[model samples]
Target: MPDHQQRIAYLLARYVNKTCSREELEELFAMIGQENGPDIPGDLLEEIWHTAHPAPDIDYEQAYLHIKPVVPIRRSLPFRKIAVAASVLLLAGAGYWWLSAEKKTAQITTVQSAPAPPILPAGNKAVLTLADGSTVTLDSAGNQVISQGKVAIRQSNGQLLYAGQPTDGSIHYNKLTTPRGGQFRLVLPDGTKVWLNSASMLRYPTVFSGKERIVELDGQGYFEVAPDAQHPFKVKVHDIEVQVLGTTFDIMAYRDEQSVNTTLLTGSIRVNKGSVQQLLQPGQQAVANNQDQQLAVRAADLRKVTAWKNGMFVFNDMALPAILREVARWYDVDIVYNTSPATELYGGGIGRDLQLADVLALLEGNGLNHFRIEGRKVIVLP
Candidate 1:
């Protein structure tokens, strides 16, 4: 095997073992869809499959059929040896298939362009505001424990946790804010865990008191509310209120969006807006339209709704403007359109951890829209 092919094999093995670094993962995916790239050896793929699944009767054709429904195949890219290798490995229960899917179909189209600086993905970073009007910049490097009265707060491995119980019967509120190109995970006093997406703000109590536990949210958040039957948990986002005793749900209430969406993953939630209210079950979504104040319920694709929380941007027949809005928020860049393309819809999921160049290339490759990155701004061209 040649040097490049050998490297691919090594990376594939490392990826199968869940030991590849982020940079290695990116390089592997970039090479997978190369039009004329070197072929991955069939024996190497068979070895990987046998090692991972030990099943002698497993049929590759049947396995591919199982994946065809869920795994998207890019019609633009030629079916290469890497695709076959991916199919075999995925059938053997390798987790690398998910990462590979993000890059397989996002090939950039040919375009004359200047080499613009790359914009990296957002990370676990945020600003925490205490009740005393003090702010702490939270990052992965900090290991300090901060105490305010009876409540203690600390960050470990990018997740902020609260220790100690509230005994003073006094309520103290703290706000966690993630700027553009940033995200954060927080554990509230009541053990409820929250994952805040980019450009989002969550105002929560340091310790629960009174009759109900309530929090105010602006922007997007995925919450796993701690079950407290007596003290119901309620989230207030704009004009909508989501009440649940215990459940996992996602709320998208960005000001730029036309409606507030609440996607329930487990348990049940009551979505209320003014006099309009609707109950949502698992796998269901409640949309509250801002214009008519009407609440609508529909079955939802949970994977697409919570893709951001899972480190992917899944767009399903999404509009161009909506897609650009998400790209701008996650990359912390401004978007300007010189001429809008005719109405276009996109369907695919890309890794949110990819650089702006890779993502823009995917968009351009689909022949949907063209973009030019200038400094911190992306300009759409005719």
Candidate 2:
């Protein structure tokens, strides 16, 4: 039988690396449920589970702070060699070298390791710029009305709401922007609930009174459009336009992506780009290329697409460059990498509430990778 401590260590390594099998994860979960299993802290256990299975109920901030990683003890030599050397030094010191030489050798062997600092968790907030060029920070309080032509813009509950009792068909535009380490939500006049991810921007009219409601987007956002049979909600990203009557969908239209992806969660939507048009159903996605004017429809995992709204950072076969883009936004930090393109296809989950260190630990669990922090920047080494 394997030693219990060795078994636990292996499981811990597998869990951190996101390489645990389902059965292994189940066993680890069972162990965590037990109060007498190892000396593992409750907070650290929660962080491990939350990273592997992120849900809306998980408190990312708590998990982020609770999971304290154990730094490896560093010596000038390997642990076995150090132990042998220490024994030899003890024998030699019995009666040979002078007291001062013996003292110096013992001092060199007195190993000291680095201690990690407490991790800090963060939340989301952003700014909204009205068509008139006035800015309103969403996280701040005090109801102030910003005039964007006839539209009355008000911020409440971190959401930018447009007063609906407008008197005309006049058009007014507003832009919602999420800065680094920030996010915001909005309820448009049409009753649509849109959640903007960090480092993203959205431009929409103050009122959607016309036959076609249109909006523009950059970065990422999740949209829950209210039913308006007469006036379809249309989202314009670069050149592609997503049209729907009433549906919940997530759109990834970041400028860096090779293809713009629109994933539908409920109801239906149509993607139209100049001469080409493609329709999508629930759990479906439309990948459109602005450069080539080509569109392809395929099945999509709805949870993975809308995970951001649920306060998670779930990735399925995502590239390292893409993953860092998201990590930089939520943590409000920059990344410096000194490694080959990550060839490993990552398939796992993590909550958005995790501290920067908590996330780096998970990434380092994977072999051939390590991370360090310098000021506000995260450096990835291999």
- Top candidate, metric TM-score: 1
lDDT of 1 by residue, 19-121 (tens): 7765775576556655566666667766765665665644444443222112223444453432463363355445434344443333222332455456899
Cα lDDT, all candidates: 0.77, 0.65
* Cα-lDDT of candidate 1: 0.77
* RMSD, every candidate, angstroms: 9.1, 13.7
TM-scores, one per candidate: 0.73, 0.69
Best by lDDT: 1
Q: Model 1: residues >4 Å from true position, as ranges?
A: 1-116
Clash counts for all predictions: 0, 1
Could you tell me how far off, in angstroms, the CA of residue 326 lies in candidate 1 after the best superposition? 0.9
> What shift in Å separates residue 334 of candidate 1 from its native position after superposition?
0.8
- The regions of model 2 sitting more than 4 angstroms off are 1-122, 140-150, 165-169
